[model samples]
Target: MPRFFCCLPLAVGVWLFSLLFFAWGTVLTVVGWYGVSSYERTDLALTRRQLVSLIITTSSWTLLPLITLFGMGAALARSPRALKAYSTALWFQFGFSVGAGAYFIYNLFRRNDGNFVTNCTSRDIADRDTCQQAFNVLRGVIVAVYVVIWLIEIWGGVIVTQYATERFQRSGGGVQFSNAPPPQGPGPVILDPVMMPPPEPPILGPAPPGRFAPNASGRFTPPGGQPQPSFVPTAGGVSLPPIIPIGQSAPQGQYAFAMPQNAHGPGAANQV
Candidate 1:
C-alpha cells in the first residue's frame, strides 16, 4: 500500500483535534471577555489585581490553543511554514503551562492566608475558596494538556523532517532518507556476436583426357603413336632429307640427291 494512504487518516484526526482546540480556545476567549466586561469595578466587587490576573490567565489559554490550531493546520497541509509555527506554538504552550502551574501552586499554598481569593467581595466565602480550587484544577489540566502537546510536537517534528528530507532529495538536493536502501551501481555491459557470409559452391566441368592428365609421378606425356618425318619445300618443289645415324656417313649409291635442273650441266637432265 502507498505511504500516504496509511498516513491520511492520522493527518485528518490531528486536524480535527486541532479544530476542537480552536473551538475550545474561542469559547474560553469569549467567556473571558464577557466576564471582564460584565463584572462591575465598584469597590465592593472583585479587586483590580484579581481581575487582571484572571484576564492574563484566560488570554494565555485562548491565544496558545489558537496558535496550536494554526500550527496543526500548517502541519496537515505539509507547508514549509509548519516547522517554525509548530515549534513556536509548542514553546509557547510549554512556557504558558509552566508559568500558570507555578502561579496556581503559589495560590494554593497561600489560599489560607487569602493571597489569591481575598478580594471576592461579590461572592460568599465558600464560593471564593471553591473558585481558587477550580483555578488550581484548571491549571493542572493545562499542564497535562501541555505535556500531551509536547509529545505530539516531537512526533510531528520527526514526520516533518522525514518529509522535508525526502522532498529535498527528490528535487535533486539533500541526502537520501535513513530508512531507504542505498542504490546499486551500474551492471555489466553485453556485446553482440558477429555474423559471417556463407561460402560459394565449387565449379562443375569435364576433366582433361590421355597425355594431358597427370600420371602416377604427376608428370604429363605426349600422345602415344609412331613419329612422322617432316618434309621441306625447295626449288625442286618438295624434298625429304635422308636420316643418317650419328657417326655414320651416307652410302655412295644407296640414296641419290636430287639437284635442281638449273644447277645441273646443260644436257644432264636430257641424258637421264
Candidate 2:
C-alpha cells in the first residue's frame, strides 16, 4: 500500500484546522493593532509597550499555524525537501512559543501583580475591572490556542518524518519481489538435444525400357518388340539363358539373343 493512503486524512485535517487557526489569530491581531493605534491616551488602557507585546504575541500565533500547513503539504507530497521545510518551521515555531509563553507568563505574574491589568484604565473602576477580566479570559484562550498549536506541530512532525523515511527507504534500493524466486549464482546451461529425421534414401527413378535391373527376374525387352537374353548369377560364372516373352515367338536359335545394347553401358538402367 502507498504511504499516502495512511497519512492523507491526517494531513487534510491538519491543513483545514491550521487555516482556521491562522484566520482567527490574524483577525485578533488586526483588531488589537487597530484598537491600540486609534484610542487616545485617556481612552486607551494599555501602554505602547503592552500594545506592541500584544501585536507580537498575536502575530506569532498567526504565523505558527502555518507550520501545520507546511507539514500537511509535506505529508501529502511525500517530498524530502518539504519534510525538511516542515521540520524547520516546526522547531522555529516551538522555540517562538517557548519564548512568547515565557514573556507572557512573566508579564502576567511578576510585573502585573498576577492580574491582567494591561488593558485596564484608572478613570473608571468598573470599566477597568471589566477590561482586566476580559484580558484574563483572552489570555487564557490564547494560551489554550498555543497548547493546541504545539500538539499539532508535534503530531505533524512525527507524521512527516515517518513518511519521509518510508520514501527514502523505498528509493534507496528496497527490493520488491513477485511470486517468482530470484536467480542464483551463475551456472552452466544445459540445453536439450535436438531430434532430427534420418537422412532420406537416395531417389532412383524407374528402369529404362530396354534394360533390366541387376536383380530383376525378367529378360530385357527393347523398344523394337524383341526379347533379349540376360545373364543370371549362379555357382558358376555368367551364363546366357533363354527368356521368351508370352506374346512373342522365340528366335530360331539354341538360346535367346545376347544382352541388349547399352544395357550395362552409360545408358544403363536406373539403380533401385
TM-score of 1: 0.40
Tell me each candidate's RMSD, in Å, in order: 28.0, 19.7
Q: Runs in model 1 with CA error above 4 Å?
A: 1-9, 38-49, 72-76, 113-272
Backbone steric clashes in candidate 2, count: 0
Tens digit of per-residue lDDT, candidate 1, span 200-219: 12213422232122244533
Clashing pairs in 2: none
- C-alpha lDDT score of every prediction, in listed order: 0.50, 0.54
After superposition, candidate 2 runs with Cα above 4 Å error: 1-25, 28-44, 65-76, 113-139, 173-272
TM-score of 2: 0.44
Model 2 weakest lDDT span, ten residues long: 194-203
Best by lDDT: 2
Could you tell me which 10 consecutive residues in candidate 1 have the lowest summed lDDT?
194-203
